[model samples]
Target: MSQAITFKNRVWENAGLLLFPDNFDEKKTYPAIISIHPIGSCKEQTSSNVYGKALAAAGFVVLAIDAAFQGESGGEPRFIEDPYERVEDIRCAVDYLVTLPYVEENRIGILGICGGGAYALNAAMTERRLKAVVSITGVNFGRLLRDGFAGGTPVESLEAVAKQRTAEARGAALFVNNMLPASVEDGKKAGIEDIDVLEATDYYKTPRGRQPNGATSVLFSRLSTGLGWDAFHLAEVLLTQPILVVVGDKPGGFGAYRDGFEIVRRAKSEKKELLAVKGQSHYDLYDKPEAVSQALEKAIPFFREHL
Candidate 1:
């Protein structure tokens, strides 16, 4: 069973989907998992069809949320994917979960996809309420853009773009080019052979994984805040909670996940482990049945043991 719910994040109201196991008993308290979608993604993309609902079906309560400033959540400067605010939103979801009579407050865990995965780890650093965390095909946005994807970007280019975006951020015409191809022809025109990039464009630009509230473009202002932030900052000492890092082994697109998983491996948790799903790209893990099933197999047991 699933129910629609809303909660407040300071003065702003946040909307979410709360999922319960089949044959759920209101009188029994069950373990809960807070499922966070990718950047520029909403609950409908993750919870409605994938991780959130699957985990709930495996006998846990799951709360899939629309981050503040995106999706159905309430916030100003829409489409701003601020890392700090995203981390707080995870904490806020935990707060809402703890208040429910049927949720096991001390047995709560969190799972984040793509950029959301980075924020989940960031939140677990300070918010000890989450007993375990799972990051799937995670990317540390700060490191990804500032340093460039896979290998590092040229320092001069990075600094130049930051300077330009920082200056334009305060102005009213805060528009930037959409990250994904605007159409299928655009993706084909780019001649990018990488399946991850190609699939992402298809997912967002086409009806395959599109959500009305999701966008491929974000406020240029986000660069000002996101560039300076580090997703794995202080993870070595502060992220003591048990963590499971899952990634795809798609040859060319695997570096981002490997980088994040490596950083998370430095944490102090003795229970931490990394699982690589062979023959899949990052986007494949988002909705592909075999990949999703493989991930849930490891994730469900990890949460059961830790949470």
Candidate 2:
């Protein structure tokens, strides 16, 4: 079972859903796992809803959290998406988990989905308290934004972001980005036929995966920092914890397939594996039972052995 909770992340409070193992007891210590959601998502969605219970059932105390500045968390300027702040979110989760008497501080691990996965990998690079990490379809947001999903987006495009940020600094209203088409029919009419885009729209905009706070939009001003950030920065040098990256074989539906491979290839972790789910797309792993199960099979054993 899971219950709503909140924890300190600097001065702001991060909202979360904490799940415990079956037959849980406060008397015994248990390994804890911090599960983080994707950009533009909340604890009520993928992090808590999809992977949290499954990981908890495997006997790991799980804390699925909403990134600060979003969801039910307290922060100024709601919907902000800053990569550095996200890394702090993970570290602060560890801070809170360690305070619980029943949590085994040294055995803490982390699970991150979509963009959350990338942030997890980045956080684990320096957050040694995280003994193990499981990144599911982790996308390198900055790289994906700087370079398009299939290829390159001109570096000059950043100029537009700079101007937008300046305008916001000058008291202009915060601009928001609509991450997906309102409907599939609208996308088709606009001649947007990317399967990845379509499937994502279907998932986030439809009942299949929609959450009240998971509209998948972001504030336009704070985006430049994310565009400038690299989720895998210095991963080859400092990432030594055991890591397992699971991605779908179908390359589209976001570049996580490509980024996941890059994570395993670049992470200096002595024990790292990249599992490719055949015939599955990136979004398929979001809530698809079969695909999520395939990832959890590898994640559960991997975390158990490492943490």
Candidate 3:
């Protein structure tokens, strides 16, 4: 049975929900999985809840959270994205999970969707308690903010973005924009190139993935904080634990996942695996049965084996 629970993130003083398994036995310690949602999306918006339910049904206790400043979590100046605080939120979730009588502290694992995926990787690096990690359609926020997609712009451009944001902050405008831009027109139009699939637009704009709280952006003042978000840079060095990276074979997100998989593989860590789902697009994996089931089929076993 799932009951609403809250835990605080020391960095932001925010409390988010902890979704547990239905048949959770207080006397028995069970394996736990921390599932993080994508950017601009809350725990309930994306497939995190679905995954949580599925994993819980498979005999695991899952915690699906709303990141700090988003969803039901507590925070001021809503929608602000603090790269460091977000990572710390994951640690806080882990802290809360381990304290539960039904949770297996040493066998905890993490799963992140979209931007949350990147944070999951970052958490694995520092949080020794995370025995395994899985990233699905994850975006490297730092690389995207600094270099844009496909490395289209120089890192110097971020400073200009930051400067503009600083000016906006001084004016106290709050700079509201939808979480993920609705269209390329909403973003830096000149830098981004068009792709065939509606991966970005479909997920952020349509009801399929969009939520009332989704697509909101913090003021430009938050740019500096987000620019420093390099979640995967140290994957090669700190990822000694087991990892499983999943990607869709369809256009738009496939290449990035491939690149991420390669980066993790080169880490020379004995415990790593990569799976590319055939005929699936980035958004397809979010709630689509075929893709989600395939992913869980491969993932649950991996965690069971490793964690």
- Cα lDDT tens digits, model 3, 156-243, are 6466566667776688466555535456565445454544224666566776666766654554446666676667667777877888
**Candidate 3 positional error at 165, Å:** 3.7
Q: Measured by TM-score, how close is model 3 to the native structure?
A: 0.87
Candidate 3 wrongly placed segments (more than 4 Å): 149-156, 179-197, 216-218, 253-255
Each prediction's TM-score versus the true structure: 0.92, 0.96, 0.87
lDDT of 2 by residue, 181-206 (tens): 89988999999878778888888889
**Local distance difference test values of all predictions, in order:** 0.81, 0.88, 0.72
Error (Å) of candidate 2 at residue 116 is 0.6
lDDT at residue 302 of model 3 (Cα atoms): 86
* Regions of candidate 1 where Cα sits further than 4 Å from its true position: 149-171, 251-255
In Å, residue 227's CA in model 2 sits off its true spot by 1.6
* Backbone clashes counted, model 1: 1
Candidate 3, after superposition: displacement of residue 16 in Å?
A: 3.1
- TM-score attained by model 1: 0.92
Model 1's lDDT to the true fold?
0.81
Range of the 10 consecutive residues with the lowest summed lDDT in candidate 1? 149-158
Of candidate 2, the 10-residue stretch with the lowest lDDT total is: 148-157
